[model samples]
Target: MIRFDNVSVTYGDAAAPAISGVDLTVPEGELVLLVGPSGVGKSTLLGAVSGLVPHFTGGTLRGRVTVGGRDTRTHKPRELADLVGTVGQDPLAHFVTDTVEDELAYGMESLGLAPEVMRRRVEDTLDLLGLAELRDRPIATLSGGQQQRVAIGSVLTPHPRVLVLDEPTSALDPAAAEEVLAVLQRLVHDLGTTVLMAEHRLERVVQYADQVVLLPGPGVAPVVGEPAEVMAASPVYPPVVGLGRLAGWDPLPLSVRDARRRAPGIRERLAGLSPTRTGPEEGDRGADRASVPDGSSGTDRSSATDRPSGRRTFMPLRGASGGRERGSAQAELPEHLAVTTRLGVRRGRAEALRGVGITVGAGETVALMGRNGAGKSTLLSAFVGMVEPASGSVLVGGLTPHRTSPRELVRQVGLVPQEPRDLLYADTVAAECAAADADAGAEPGSCRALVGELLPGVRDATHPRDLSEGQRLALALAVVLTGRPPLLLLDEPTRGLDYAAKARLVVVLQGLARKGHGIVLATHDVELAAELAHRVVILADGEIVADGPTADVVVSSPAFAPQVAKILAPQPWLTVSEVREALR
Candidate 1:
């Protein structure tokens, strides 16, 4: 139902096309996954299908793009609204109504559908996406993941023939992501709907795609093939595929189930070899308290300790001062960079966090995980002083966060929020970095250097708005790091990054941790937690449900386990790198 003939898209006065030499035919009722590294024009290609390219986006589109045999070149986005549904990377930007129910019905209303049909479709969509409980919630009050589901439900309510989605599950938890993907599967199989999706979290969606379209790089010809064939040699892939490649499995497995079917031999080969844990020892604070079997002993119980009945409350940090003497302050800083005791936060008649207690030590990385609206982001906000606690206390570098001045807070903590663009206002990347350095009183090249290390190939002259979602996230992270705070907080840090960029990020964060920086990231990327985090903290309904060693917390929970852990189950392995290192 969708065709791209010799397609090439280029923005104004660029050195080359953002994407070029693209040609493919997507049959009706099939789901096509667009795979590539960040900033490779996957979004551009998806835009072309929905008639946003060269029309609403003000880009030059070469060749032809047709949907349902209707030429996209001649049809504007509004004209094709009935036939096409497009959800961009940012869900907040897609909303046209205030409440969940309104947003879902707005699309159908725009299409001039009958009142009865719109009401039925809206209810069906709310149930399909698990948004029934949030039907009356305002769009602005919902969590990022909730907003994503609402955006998708809005599109689905219109009953369009084609669905073009960019990172549909980026903000969702594993179970919610599965629910949304399952709905897509039903639409494709039961209703003959066409879906073209671009996502960075390949681990979540690769197994569900009907076909894979691989975009190698900017201006490079596209490669189209079966999911397994394309992923075998594709530069970017999920952890399960990487594990399959490492084990020399034929026709590399796309899902954990497939890998498990072939894992018996590898399991025996890895016997007596323990997975590597390079971070703090188990004796450190926040370590699993239960007498779980260590990997070295060849016992693979994979069970982490349950939540402690009596949570530990830390004393406030000491010697924290707002002064110009950076060296003196660094020496006086306590081991606990951040501490929260029975923290409670309320937002708009809802308790966002309840009785939450956590701690972050110097040179340690902790991952905050949970389902959508699970209070993960709210906890991050509490740390950064974005939200005031309704009860209990929060201390960062020995000082209360909400009571501290903005200038002093920058010296103690920094946060990269879920929406990276919120921290960037400069026109160009160079200007943003310069401003960051100036604000933090750092060396001239400080922020620029971090950007170079975290995200290579980002031009200094590139506009922040023009960059892809992943690139924008990296730039925002670099800006936050410019201040060189003792504690760093990241919300959905890997939202748009591919495997390669994410690896670079892991390396950079690891280096920071080695240098005594405390990092707390709120994310749904279990692979990232497995690869980089020393501790895992799970939240549920505004409360801490699980907090322990990374392996223990994730391996035991089927919903949050990484692909590598799921495949290598009955073994304590968490990542392909850990397995490779153990074998070596």
Candidate 2:
């Protein structure tokens, strides 16, 4: 249905082409997953399908891209609206209406469909995406994940033959992501629709893909093959694939069921060895004393101000017989850094958060997880004073966040919001770094250096808007970290990040935690939480339902468990690293 013949795209002022010599074909009624590292032209490749490339993006097209035998060069995006439905990474940018129902119907109206037909399609889409309850809510009042679903429903309502999605499930929780993927499966199997999706969270979508397209990097030809073949050598992959490779399986398992069928052999090899559990050291109470600005032990402080200043030291724990330890108390305890009491937040008539209470500790990484519209983003907003609490109080270092001034807040806390573009306004990356340096009062080139650490080889002259979703996120994170705030908050930090980029993020965040930085991130990436988070907090209907150590929280909830945890049931292992260590 979609064909790229010797395709190459180069934007103005770019030294290299975004994509080059990409000759590929996606058969009709099949789901093709586009995979690659950050900024490797996955988005650019998707844009070519919907006629967004070299059209609305202002780039030069060297070769032809066709959808349904219709050349994109001859058909602009508007002309191909009925044939192709494209949803970008930022859903808010795609909406033209105020309410969920209106947004879903907007595309059908544009296509000049009958009113009755449009209404029925809108209702079907709302039910298919589980957006029926949110149909009357205004787009502005909805959460990031809700907005993403609305954007997808809006496109789906049009009933286009081809659907192009960029990070379609990035903002969705595990359950919601499953719903979206199931809907896509139905479209491919029952309706004969073609889906070309580019996503960074391979763990969520790899098994569902009919085929895989791996773009190694810029200027490198893409490799298209079976999912297993591509992931074996692909720079980015899911944990299950990593486990299969480690176990020397003949064919790498794509799903948990397949992995479990082969798990008996591996389980026997490490029969009595217990999984290693790592966390904050016990009896190291003074480890974070320097993080308290006033040297007070009480939780009266509003925010933390001590920046992360040291490296992390890892120590392995063993039993008396020199075997790995399990169910240790030190691995589950948290050193408190900030606490909230009966927090309540209201946005207009909506109770975004109600009696939400949680604590974050220095050197601890806590993941806030829930379904869409569950107040994860709202809670994060309250921590940074972007949203004021209506009833309860929040105490960071010793002060209330809403009462703190912007100048002081930058030193106390840093937030990488859901919309990375909201933190960027400068034209070029160099300018953005300079502005961040001035705002944070950091040394010259400090922000730029941080950006390099997160995203290497990106040109200083590149426009911030021109960068990929993951690159933009990295730049925003660097801009926020320039202040070296003791508390760091991230909302969907891995929205567009590939495995390589996410690995780098894990290392950076771990380093910051070792240096006494308290990290609270609201995310839908379960693999990330399993690998990095020390604790997990699950929110639902604007209230906290569960909070505990990572292994306990995730393993108890089937929807939130990682691939490894699910495959190795009856075992306490949460990650591939844990399994590998146990085997060793």
Candidate 3:
């Protein structure tokens, strides 16, 4: 239903077009997944489908893009609202209403639909997206994942024939992502709707796509084919596909279940080896050492100990028992880097966090995982003093976060919020870095150097808003790290990162953990958790439900398990690199 004929989009005064000479057709009733690295114009391509590229984004379109045989050149986004619904990466920006129910119904009201029709569609969307409980919640009070679902539901309520989504599941937990994907599947199969989705988390959605559109960077024509055909040469891919490539499987598996069917021989090959752990050893921090089951690689596991019983374990670093200097490097920081005791936070009349207690130790990486509206974001905010606890206390570097001054808080704790845009304000990358250095009293080039390490080749002259989602995130991360906070909090750090970018991030975070920095990341990316997190904390309805070593927490929970863990199950392996290391 969507067609791009020799399409090319270029912003004002750029050396190369964002995308060029792309001729593609997405059939009606099919879900087409747009895959690419960070800045290959996936968003631009999606915008063309919804007529937002040249219309609202102020870009020049070389060729025509059509939806349902109507040229987008002639139809503005508002005019095509009934035919095509678009949801951008930032959900909060899409909302024009205050509450969940109102946001969902806003689109239909704009379309001037019958009140009864709008109400019925709103209820259906709420149930479909599992947003019924959150229907009355304010959009601002809800978690990032909840806001994403609401954004999608608001668009879906319009009952458009075509849906264009940008990172639809980036903020959602695995189960919630599956629910959203399933809803899309139903729309495609039952209602003959067309879905054009662009996502960085290929592991979650690759298996469900009817076709794949691969954007291989600038100046290269886009490649469209069946999922497997495209993934073979596609630069970015899920862990399962990488495993299939390593094992020399005939057709790369898109999902864990498919990979498992062909895993027996490979399991035999890796029987006697141990998988590699991506981070530092637990080192007497009461780290849980759970064993893999028998079916996993046929490996014996008598040496593994029983799982620990507390919600979490905190091991104090060498100097942490007696408060040390606050500006110490990662190595000199104390083990109890940050602590929360019976934390309770409320927004208006709604309680966002209740009796929440957690600890981050020096040289430790903790991942906070949960369903939408589970208070993960709220918990992160408490650490940075963005939200004050109504009861109990939060201490970062031996000082109360809420009571600390902004200047002092920067040195103790730093947070890269859910929306990277919130932290970025300067016009150019160089200016942002300069401002960050001044604020943190760091070396002149420190922020720029960090940005290079996180995202290489990013020009200093580029506007922060002009950068792609992943690049903007890297820049924001750099700005935050300029303060050199002992406690680092990242909410959905891997939102738009490609596999390669994510790999670099894993290395960076691992280095920080080894140097004694304490890290707490609120994320829905299970693969990321498997790579960098030493401990996994699962939140649910404002309370901690499951907290343990990464292996125990993610391996046991099907929804949270990584691709390799699922395929190599019965072994507890969490990543493709882990499996490869075991074989070697």
Candidate 4:
């Protein structure tokens, strides 16, 4: 259905082509998974199939590309809209209508379909994607994951022969991601549709793909093969593949079931050891932090001016074993890093949050997780002063967040939002870093240094828009970290990051925690929560349903557990790193 003959794409007067010397064919009615590191032209390759590379993106095309035998060069995106359905990374950009129902119907309307056909497809799509409950909600008011589903539902309703998706499940929770992937699988199996998807979260979609196309790097020829063959040596892989490689499994497992079938021997090997935790234990407000190497800085040197006066510092309370005493008497509580008492937030007629209360101490990491529209993002917004509570209070460093001045609040707290582009407006990366330094009162090149660490090889002359999604997210994180805030809030921090980039981020965040910074991140990446969070907080229907230690909370829940935890059930292991530590 899709063919690339000697394809190469170069934008403007670049030193090297974004993708080069690629000759590939994707059979009809098959799902092809595109795997690669960030900025390796995976998006560019997908764009070629949709005719957006040279036509809409204003790039030079060196070779012919065709979809359903229709030459993409001759057929612009609008010309091929009937045959191809493309959903880009940013869903808000893809939206054309205000409400979910309207957005889903708009595509079929553009195609000039019959009214009855459009109505039927719209209803089927809403039910298929579990968007029936949100059909009347405005697109702008929905959460990030909800917007993503709406964008997908809009495309699915059109029922095009070919589907091209970029990071389709990046914003979704685990269950929602599974539902979306299952829908795609059904499309391939039952409807004979061709799907070409590029995603960074390989853990979610790898097992469903029939063929794997790997762009090894920029200017490198593509490698096409079976999923296991490609994943064995792929630079970026999920935790299952990592575990398979670590344990010398002959054929790498792609899913938890396969991994578990091969895990008995290794489980026996690790029977003598316990999985290692990366942060303070749960229910211990003053526990000694687990030692983690400093990947970002040397020590906690936050400015006293950024903190409120006359607040007591919380000391690390420990027992004789350097661990928190399980049943010891609790000490008088000191001023917390953040506190929310009976918090309530309303969006339109919906209660986004209600009767919510949580606290964060110095040097703690917490993860907020839930299904789409479950109020995780709203709670993060409350911490960053983006939304004012309708009832109760939100305090950071002892001052109310909604009442605090923007200038002072930035120093006390910082947020990297789900849409990283919202925090960027500068023309070049260097300009953005310079402006961040000035705004945060940091040393010259402070933001640039952080950018280099998070996303290396990003040039000063490159526009922020030119960077890949993961690179843009890293740049936004650097801008926020430049402020050296005591409290950090991240909404879907790993939306576009691959395994290696995420590990680098984990190390950097660990370093920040060691420096007495408190972090709260809202994410659906269960692997991230397992690796970085001391505690996990689950939200459902705008209220906290469960909150406890990371292992205790995620290991028992089938939907929220990571691949490692699921593979080695009854062992309480949550990550490949923990398993590796125990094995060693």
lDDT by residue for model 1 over 377-483, one digit each (tens)?
Answer: 88877776767899999999887877876555656777777878767878999998877666655567777887887778889999999999999999987877666
What lDDT score belongs to each candidate, Candidate 1 first? Answer: 0.84, 0.81, 0.81, 0.82
The clash numbers for all candidates, in the given order, read: 0, 9, 3, 0
Q: What value of lDDT does candidate 1 attain over all alpha carbons?
A: 0.84
Clashing pairs in 2: 300-398, 301-397, 301-398, 301-399, 302-396, 302-397, 302-398, 302-399, 303-397
The CA lDDT at 234 in model 2 is 90
| Candidate 3 wrongly placed segments (more than 4 Å) | 278-332
* TM-score list, all predictions: 0.92, 0.90, 0.91, 0.91
Regions of model 4 farther than 4 Å from truth:
281-335
**Worst ten in a row by lDDT for model 1:** 295-304
Top TM-score model: 1
Worst 10-residue lDDT window, candidate 3: 292-301
